[model samples]
Target: MADIGGKRVAILATNGFEQSELEVPRDKLREAGAEVHVISLESGEIKGWDLKDWGRTVPVDRVLSDVSADDYDALVLPGGQINPDILRAEPAAIDFIKAFWADKKVIGAICHAPWLLVEAGIIEGRKVTSYHSIKTDVVNAGGKWEDSEVVTDQGLVTSRKPDDLPAFCAKVVEEIGEGRHERRAA
Candidate 1:
């Protein structure tokens, strides 16, 4: 697999982000030389939810309102039901994600994270995967929802859940390392 080698990746997450979904990929991406930045709606720290209880707190590097999609090579959305749900309701958060699609940057979403995609109105006409519960939402939003553990459609890559993290991270790193292309930017 190719290394990201200093590629800047943005992870848009907030309180209630699934612990593994956020930490695993972030760690792997950084290990491969990607500069991972956690941007959230909060100013200080964001809490993570382990399967049943509170897990840990990660410092928020930037606020959603401060990010420009053009400054990143890729975008990551870590799912936890609450995280994306809250984000989907935030205008700035949705706009930040919309800018990523407009710029054609690699967009990686896991579990229920794609809810933000549906809210941003960018999944239509594309194939994607997410936590099975929201499969209908993807379809309803005009996206071709799939049952696969991972799906990579165009510049967008998605996965089912924490179990899919390995493949998800691998695909995300691949997308980021591929470099930007005009087709994605348009």
Candidate 2:
């Protein structure tokens, strides 16, 4: 793992986030020396959805109202059917994601998490991959969706599912280490 010793990464998620998707990359990033924070709709804790049922709870480090894209070096979006669906509907969350995209900061999204990216209007013309169920949504949003284990476009990193966590986390660390990327003019 690369040493991101002073970098700060924000995981934007809410209740019902996929358990593994949220935890795996977070633990991996933390182990690589990056400061990781869980930012959500509120303070206190948010629960995870483990496949069929509710999973463990993670403490909220900061609330969406209190943090901005400038607060971190990279932004992570963890996917769960419920998590992204709720987040995509929240204007604050969508705006926060848009700010990160506009700044060319590293943005990592997995599974259904890309829904937020689609909602943020940053997916058009970008190459990405996500859980199969949302393939149509990504394509409909103008993104070139692939079936690969992981895909990286500019500073954006995305993966297909929870099983792709190892590859996803590695690419995220690599991209964050590379810092901001320049997106070609549309």
Candidate 3:
């Protein structure tokens, strides 16, 4: 496990995020010694979507307007049908993602979270994976879609679903430890 002590990681999410996807990674990163922040569109807490119904709410560490991409070493996007859909439509969210890509900072998107990457226009020619239903969206956006538990292209880490959370979280830590990548800037 990478002991990324003092490293700052931001988890970009809003209401409707998959419960396990966000919580697990956030916890794992924190345990690995990274300072993790839950950033959202609003200042208040956001509710999460469990397997079926709404789950617990996660308090927001900071709002989108208050955060700068350069403050964090890695950006994590947790997926749920509603979560990514809302984020993809938000210009601020897309801009942050683009900033991370431009800096070659670590970016992890699991499940439907890859939608944000597609909207940011950074996944062109990048290999990625997501929830099975969004495979077409990834492909159409110029990403080489793969069916796997986890896929890491450059500093980008993606996974298929909640079942793949273990692998996804590990890859996020590994990428964070490696620091910025030398991938082509967006």
Candidate 4:
């Protein structure tokens, strides 16, 4: 396993997030020794969408307007059709994603979560993978889109769907442990 001890991972999402997309990776990352914080657009708790219906409610650690990119080692965007759709429309959320990239921190976006990356204008020239339906959007945004279960380019790691969770979580833990950009590249 990767040595992600003491690293801090910020998961940015909101209500209606895909339940497995958020919970599975979050649990795995935490178990790997990363301190995970869930930041959302609103206060209180954000509801999750399970496979076919509503599921658990995860508490928000802080509002997007209040968090800083420098405070964490990585950023995670857990996707559901509605979650990233709403977040992409929020300037604050878009800015948060931009800041994480500007800082060169590890960024993980699964499924439709790449919508946030497109909204942030950071997808240009990058190679990424996302849910099959959003590949067009990713390509249109200038990203070299792929159909792989997980794709890591530069410092970002993206996955195609919930079924890719195991590989997705493992890569996140690996990247967070890398800590430095040069080490991450090699």
Highest-scoring model, TM-score:
2
Model 2 / residue 171 / CA error / Å: 0.3
Each candidate: RMSD to true structure?
A: 1.8, 0.6, 1.1, 2.3
* TM-score to native of every candidate shown: 0.95, 0.99, 0.98, 0.95
lDDT tens digits, residues 24-120, model 3?
Answer: 9999999999999999999989999998999999999999999989999999999999999999999999999999988889999999999999999
Q: Model 4, range 1-186, lDDT digits (tens) per residue?
A: 686888998999998899999999889998998899999988899999997898899999888778888888899999999899999999888888888888888999999999999999888888899999998999999999988999988778999999999999999888877774531321
**Cα lDDT, all candidates:** 0.90, 0.96, 0.94, 0.89
Q: Global CA lDDT of candidate 3, please?
A: 0.94
For model 1, give the 10-residue run with minimal summed lDDT: 177-186
Per-model tally of clashing residue pairs: 0, 0, 0, 0
Order of the predicted models by lDDT, top scorer first: 2, 3, 1, 4
User: Model 4 off-target regions past 4 Å?
Assistant: 182-186
lDDT of each residue in 13-117, candidate 1, tens digit only: 999999999999999999999899999987999999999999899999998777799889999999998899999999999999998888878999999999999
Candidate 4 local distance difference test against the native: 0.89
State residue 148's C-alpha deviation in candidate 4, in Å. Answer: 0.4
Scored by lDDT, the top model is 2
Q: List the residue pairs that clash in candidate 2.
A: none
Error of 3 at 123 (Å): 1.0
